[model samples]
Target chain A: MESAIDTHLTACPRTISRRVPDAYQPPFPMFVGRADETLHQVTMAYLGVQYRDGGQRTAALAAVAEIVGTFDIADGPAHNDITRHTDKEGYVNLIVVGYWRDPAAFCRWLRSPDVNGWWDSPERLSGELGYFREIVSPRAEQFETLYAFTDNLPGVGAVMDDISGEINEHAYWGSMRERFPLSQTDWMESSGELVVVTGNPADGGRVVVQGHDNIALIRSGQDWREAGPEERALYLEEIQPTLQAGMDFLRDNGETVGCYSNRLVQNIDLDGNLLDETYNIGHWRSLEKLERWAESHPTHLRIFTTFFKVVADLDKLRLYHEVSVSDGANQIFEYLNCHPSTGMMRDAKVMASR
Target chain B: MESAIDTHLTACPRTISRRVPDAYQPPFPMFVGRADETLHQVTMAYLGVQYRDGGQRTAALAAVAEIVGTFDIADGPAHNDITRHTDKEGYVNLIVVGYWRDPAAFCRWLRSPDVNGWWDSPERLSGELGYFREIVSPRAEQFETLYAFTDNLPGVGAVMDDISGEINEHAYWGSMRERFPLSQTDWMESSGELVVVTGNPADGGRVVVQGHDNIALIRSGQDWREAGPEERALYLEEIQPTLQAGMDFLRDNGETVGCYSNRLVQNIDLDGNLLDETYNIGHWRSLEKLERWAESHPTHLRIFTTFFKVVADLDKLRLYHEVSVSDGANQIFEYLNCHPSTGMMRDAKVMASR
Candidate 1:
């Protein structure tokens, strides 16, 4: 039965998996046999310009802020896995990550007119720019993922249910493989397994995985004091459904055995901004298993397709994946212990100081 | 007799001479030697300090201007190598090059009361100051030399006269060797033969030598309209002498060789502020030669000893060195037809435009 679906899916060139091990199987029972599914990882980069002149610098910053404000998640079926950072005094770098069913569906989003319009915006001008360079190589060469820890668990039907619900509602990833097939292969071949572990390591915690290039911890900020009541309510209501949808997709198509997941709150900075706010980090038995889930799973496909459509017009919101190899711990202890400086955290800290 | 001199000079750490294959002794007994007799390269970084409340930037700029104004040949010896560039809004970056007997000699002048007092002077003080950070590294890597193209047909009498004159006026080599024996060996070993060519490749025009890692050019800037009469006179009378001294030192030391020297220049800003400036970039036939010079020379010893004495009291000065390798043609094209850029070239162009 599983072989039958695999044959059927092979008809779609965009949905074809690069190399799937014969022993591959899904963690959960689904409509299609686990043997039939394919998975792919995708990464994208969004560069923000910073001009040398003060006036132009101001203009660039404003444009970036405006773009970030327009990020939406309801426009398509794509799933979003993204992170953003800025050099205190220089440029802004954004990385977006997610999975896809195949390359064909991914290509449709790249050629979209919405993305082109943002690049051609009138306000995107630099003053006396000295260095303006861009680089795009396979994430495998650029970075490595050595460590990952999370609290969510596989077989928790609730999480998988949420993921499927979100995908069905948004219909995001179905067409991406045909549109951006190359991107899917590039990401899958380059990225490593996403490791998910249990517990908060910061509050007298320990990491389950020993060697990883990057570690993303997932947690909820329900206890965070800086968030106003209204803000907290709005976040829980809006994000829960989306997050549930993601969980549902993973439960149905993800592989089990040697897999892990974790849930944690976001890290915050001194300025009340989100530091590292990844929704969840999951560890697969191998990259091969992750690829399978991404390729043939309908729920996973819908999540990603919707994500790209929502932020397609926003220049600041980028989607990319990085595959890094970490020889030793690159992150400092101080960075790991601190919450990002959000208003809730700042207020709580102030109260404690007093 | 020539063999005897070669034997003696070869043994003398301070003296370097290359034997002519067939001594058809021209008008002067021409014995080629290495240039940059000072045998030391010094690098200094100037940092401007500004206040926390935006006053620091202006203060830093002013301090930069003040430092640039104090450049002079008598302070030590300059090699006509200086670079000054500014951004679009006319902020400045100034680098001055010159040669010194050693770091001690350079530092004493740098930290002298006269130089330090300028920082406190009411007219110059902005309550914002700039400082120097010194870095001294013996050149032990990335050094090479290629010597060619010289006037070989000069009468033996003329050559002898030139050699004798050099010996009489700058016979400091003997005592210098006595004081610092190790400094002399590296140069003696690396010094190449003095070849007399048929024509002056660098005569009446500019000779531009550019390589993968190095660039050296000598030209007449008589027509460049970048400076006023005072600046022009200063360039001709004051700057020219120092430049000539360097050229003569190179000619006497070896037929043609490369050595590090100091960079010196008058720091003039777009706002027309003048700065007192002094720094060094020692050169040698090779990195080994530089290292030997640093370890052995007595003049260098005395110079460095003096430098540390005043360093404790100085407001600022810095020194460091970087070694680089080259592969492509190191020597660029020689322009025999054109005159160097003097202040007059701009005026001629402007008049023509009118």
Candidate 2:
């Protein structure tokens, strides 16, 4: 294979030749867990990138390239990755999202010697650099995830399994089956593929075929520098108003629809300059409620439709959507030395054990 | 005064009408104590601006309007105010810079019933709301502040006294009196008017003339929407790089020369939108050290020189500079549940008694 790749690249100028490994394993592997019990927790780690000058530099970003460094560590999460990286001048940001099979197990690992030495090291505590962390255990049912394909699971999805090994079970948009089926489908239309991985009957639950999914994702163009009057109009006349109204409607209405939180993110360069990409991650209590809001909700349907159209025409810009669901036992969250607005921390007692 | 406003507006029919008070007092008051004491502390309060929509409507802003409400309470500092208010869309920023005679007193208030109840309330705990507080306590000698004139104190300056009550102090730029002397001159250039509030010889120290002052403040025009190519260059080539580098120099070197922390603030509406104005608040251990950096520091000198040139040429734009020096005792700091980057939180433990 190495010779073949080297020879192949020789035919093309400017193509560097390198040896390729013939036997390969996925950088991150699926979770190893008990067959009978429910075991999983969601973990989100917030890491900061420190800049020296013109270059984007930080140990945190570099650490991300070493994928699954802690995957095999005892009591650690089943999966982890530097899921998000954003940069601005003088500062860079890296976010690691992962999932544990058990909340207690993850906590134990956190207090263990290896983890404590790294996080609580004297050099780290020096305070010269900036850093923060947020850990959440999503009550399994509290979340819904949709993937483009069964082979790839992101963050928490990597810790849990689908209902079946193949795409045999049919799942609807707002049904219970959509979240945890052994074999899953891209019912939310956000995840790219439709293939499914088999699941264990003894483990948690499975996604049974329902009908359709309700979760709606709104993504703007990747670049909007030439964002003329038309682009601004989309934000002002359509996008902004729709989002504001939707949030208001959902909050005022109720929680059955699965909407729990709203998150907005924008990409940035090392200089902290704003990027063209923006993502809105909203939580839904259930897919049915999400569907109702997407299909029947008067204001939301219009807003989402317009967003879809704007992205359709922009060639340089790309948009994506996804949704996922978790069972109660597999979800978890922990908020530490943080502000009141930190997820669940406001009401959570300071250092109080539940 | 009321009639004069009415007469002046006669040329413009659209002028609004409201009665002006004949007698007025500054919303925040000076510290009360014996004069011979060190009598200074640095306070930086991060107050959240709640967002319902696009408006800057927030209890935090409203609370700031009622200045020094907690100053009189026992264990509370003699003065604190929402000294800095900057806003952006969906968020409002309020910063209350204050000083405490004793750092311990500030900690007492944080744990007291009044502050805890308001901050720890259920409404505040909801993850939907954003809230954070950063407390920095620079040793008295660790910080110096400069104001354009007498009678105006921002953050910690509000705690210390100026040179004279009647504008008699002739303090110059780079004079020791700018920071520690009983009476100070308009060394900062940002504070308006050269007037002094009468000070009791027994109550704390005054801005005594020792030598030079450090710390620079930069403010552009009221709006930057039309900030053309020149403006962009100033930020890209001069302002941003200089600011970033200056911070690096201060941190890399020890605090002997008045270099401690770098602060850059932009004026914003209640809605948290950016304003044209920007303020740089850097802590200097001493005035002479600050002067050394200002006059000799390669990157900073270049930055300040360009800033001076630009502000000198533009009529619509405004630029101001000031420097201050404080004693160790009066320069107390209190940090509560905050990231290590917060003033001294990295060294200060959570709720730990010093």
Candidate 3:
């Protein structure tokens, strides 16, 4: 690893190869260990419901929540969280997020009698409440994770063993792509176009959107709960502005830059109290597009420079991100009685079942 | 109406009664017409799914989207928008937001052969994808809508008839509460505690959180797409700063001021293009709590004053909000295979089913 860093000192900034110094150390820790071939698959699952009129909302959710609480540690996800959010449509949605290092384990848990039986029950479709489960499984090579503080972890981090100390391939342009193990052998280009699987959402029918290859998903997060007043002020006043600007650029004009959709959200407690945490979740057309934006975009440049300038003064402020490139075959887009602009329904062509 | 406004000139600022000049017109149009008792109920529906690994995601979503597209105008929501966002748990979520002025219409649509048949099909539980529907129906008196522009209506506004000329109720504190017709006869106080209907989420069982009455839901939005460069700069530089500060206060310390949860999110197009729109959706314990914050809090005052100060220069910028206070029995929270912090699952007591 040391020799590799030395050899890449002259690596082109435009190229995929990474350049780093022997004594270089990132201000934060990151995830590593692709060498462990056995740990190659990771899966995430969300089980949720949407309801209103109070007639059956409470009863319906209780039925589902009860089932989730019955799984044993061995057969269940590594970690789980229950959250609620009001969708843009004004419905309060309750979601249970579960993570598994092994997709097979997730399958087993889903196949369990109690789980399958509840889903199979006719009560689920009794017009009382709406229920759903969404899951994603990605190979180890398809994803990467980084962290600032090891204390409070999220998503895959909650299931992973540990985070690495100062690593060589970060803090520079294109480091996000350089960190991806898949990027080593694959350019992660998107192939094909989005195809709608059913009728049009605008006209009201079952709609499914099929995306192209090598789509990218990113979760970049910040945590300042442990920050002192000074560090907190520095983050809120200095670091946040540039970060928000970059995010705003992506949210408003990302398509022009290879990005798809971006959302900046604050994490709150179940009772609705806001926590000192926030994150940006987005989807990109391809990993290369994301890389291009991060490498050359002025918005990202400002965020990059601001971080470096205030790195020393920032303590107890954790900044980390996870990036993954998934095959088109591994995506899902669906809607029912939804607005026309929901998901990829409007972007993709309707599928011809013929 | 003129006499009513004049008579309330000395009305307590902290009370629900509104006071405004007869000639004073708001810069933006607002929704009115409580006199028409026929339009008493409003319903919002969210039919969505969560999926990943590519195998069932696109297919499942397409299936659902097709069903939504089949609804006829008279039997369907007045308007719809298909949107997608990545959930905090790492799964991509696609949702169709639908609105109906009559809950009966929503029920008729949901019970339609195509809709119910599709939902009841055994394939729904075939482990291909997770599906759900979340709906909220509130009487006209319990909900209020305000819009800056009639052209870009959202949520209930999309289904509403026409916007009214300058209304006398806005631009002051406590105006939000006063806008709700329900406030005239009811204080809109919360009545019950959240009771978990099922098992514990931490232990991997089904969990349902039943909430109390008068849970306040507010959606505040901003649209600056029509603004020119100067107006945009004023919003981005001067207005946005104070607005965000106020939102931040609610997000981080909302519990102290009656907020339950607050999420600041950006609206995006189907292709993931960032729209020139953003909104903050929040849950509050009670209407009074929210009223107190908007009335006396310095943070809100800053937002109010800032908006008034720049109202003239902000020609094309649009600002709007919808506030609804619902009975606790109307609220539904359910979790499946989720983490403890997913929703009210962590805060409520577990149901002791005898």
Candidate 4:
């Protein structure tokens, strides 16, 4: 039964709640939580380098290693990881991901002479080497995290103390929104357009595109390394196929449903060997459309039904996701010598030079 | 000299032209051209799978291999490549890229029982395995390609007959836009907001977001595998540092300048080893802001100055890029069980349930 307060809290009649049914027990205990209060805002920074060819990455590798070393020391990121990936153009991306529990610390690190000097160095203009850093800081209320197991947690989990025990909010369509603390009062509505606030490409040099408000970002992860052979078989054979279909629908045809881009990626080791984890990173125009996909799409329905069918027997599988709605004022969209179809460039407006 | 006809062709007085100075030769005679005319509209598709963990990827690998085998048919793509990468969430991603010279052929293949059945199969919804396919088709006029060398051409290069010799347009800030055919007349301005046309996240269902018009995309590449030792040194030591600095400016602080997201990625082989190629794929709000970065920003000036100083000795360095402005209607972005901070979600709008 819904209490008057609960009803009032979720003003929208159709809105879901994060509160679990009274005395309801989950088939398997799962956990999800956020960073400590000290981390009122979390900052994630990806500093990377792109070499023209793989044969000459020694210098680039050393560059990132040094930076990683710097971040590993005191007054640095709470957690950091070095990862690799190759893009459609056959570019190898070496990224050093650093998570800061405090925005002030992140800002301080950025302004530090060591970091600024490295970024401002003239040697970075090599015709064969390219470098970049992408940083985002979201308030505690803007983002959420969930974990399947306590070991080997990624992202904000590094700064978090412990995995809070399950308190409902799983196996449902609107559960994600319900999990978000922001849903209490704010609808998280989107505002503004992907409008150009500066020069156009025709005049050519560097073009900057401004993003809209409340653009949504989601990183859904699944870690099932500890599953027993039988549960693993069930997951691999039964649940996985259904999940793939839903992901495939979004990857190939998500534009129809408001998805901008979706990548179903697996985790790997330094040796290019596969790891025991995988995740789907997607960008949506708004949180509403993402909700609609989960609530009504046939693709997701199959995923929903398939998971529930074997929920009782699947004890080892770990599933969790985190979603954040960003402020447009904090967003960035710039292109250098890149393809016009890259990223937000596909849909942003081109304004005349200011 | 501006021919009367040329003046008439370029309606915008402020727009730059692709024509080079009279009889002016490039330092190393760089080459750039488009894919063969046979490819009126090119379609690029990426088919991939995501597993719960790396330990259980044997099945996923076999699945992709089977699909790759099928795509190798005579009626399949004109070219293809298999690549790998790990994302921020530590997910391993295996991608099989296929390029088609004809969109109709791509359509035909998508509907083929072999491909269609594979995609539509109920077995794909497994809880542990996720699959996805991303496809994009751009008309000949909508895209432009450039190459520093003839060998190891990527993207449309596989379909091209030869690397057309230098035709004069080189070494300029606005060169990318000048290289684009659409820039000759069309301003490529954006025309819509990222609006929600359906259900909100609160509704707990699938929601569809609508995109606007005239979004741009760019794929700028650098292949220095064939560069001489001295040129490589110049690139690795002198030129690279400066380029990295500029890229860093965009990556770290580009939000203030209008960039949505930028990734400087290198190309890697299957073994997770670095390759001899690299590129930067960026998403901008518009072509205009990109131009501003290039034209007035000091970061790009260093890139331009450094290249000019060493242009004479850089004989083996290969640098090329392709830019395209997409129709927003053809775009797709969706997220399922993903972290909220992924991709364009950082600044998109969120509408209420309709």
Candidate 1 stretches greater than 4 Å from native: A1-149, A153-354, B1-41, B45-69, B75-105, B111-354
Question: Mind giving the per-residue lDDT tens digits that candidate 4 earns over A185-239?
Answer: 4567667556656545444334466777777777776667788888778778876
User: Across residues B1-354, which tens digit of lDDT does each residue of candidate 4 receive?
Assistant: 112122223346533233222333334455565444465677767565555556746776776687787785546998876655443445455556687888788888878888878776766653455555545576666666666565767866676565665544544334555555566555566665455454443332223445555545555666678788887887788767777777767666766766654545566544445677766655566665565555445455556556656655556787666666566655544332223323333335676443
* Cα distance off (Å), candidate 2, residue B55: 18
DockQ values per model:
0.00, 0.00, 0.01, 0.01
lDDT of 2 by residue, B1-354 (tens): 111111211223322111111121212111211122354444444443333343444555554443245545677666553323322222334554445645667778767777767665655434333344434443343333333333344345445544223121112122223223322212221111111122211221221111122222211112233456776556556666766566556544524444544445565543435555556555554343454455434455455445544543443233334344433322333322222233322112232231
Model 3 Cα shift for residue B123 (angstroms) = 96
Overall local distance difference test of candidate 2: 0.38
Candidate with the larger lDDT of 1 and 2: 2
**Of the candidates shown, which would achieve the greatest lDDT relative to the real structure?**
3
Alpha-carbon lDDT, every model: 0.28, 0.38, 0.62, 0.59
The sequence of per-residue lDDT tens digits that candidate 2 reaches over residues A1-354 is 111011211233322111111121112111211112253334433332232333434454454432245546788667654423322222334444445656677778778787666555555434333333434443343333432233344445456654122121111112223223211222222221111122211221211111112222222112343456676556556666666566556544434444443444455443344555454444454443355445434455455445534643543223334344433333333322222222222222232231
Tell me the lDDT of model 3 at B322. 82
Determine which window of 10 residues in candidate 3 chain A has minimal summed lDDT: A1-10
Evaluated on chain B only, what are the TM-scores of all the candidate structures, in order?
0.28, 0.44, 0.75, 0.74
TM-score of each: 0.19, 0.27, 0.43, 0.43
Tens digits of per-residue lDDT for model 1, A1-354: 122122322334432331211222222221211112233222222223334334544454444444333333222113333333332233332323222223334345434555445544332322232111111111212222111111221111111112111011111111122112232222223123322132223331222222233222111122223345554444355443555565544433233422233222233332225652333433333332343344323333344333333333322222222221222132111111112221011111111221
- Candidate 1 at A80: error in angstroms? 20
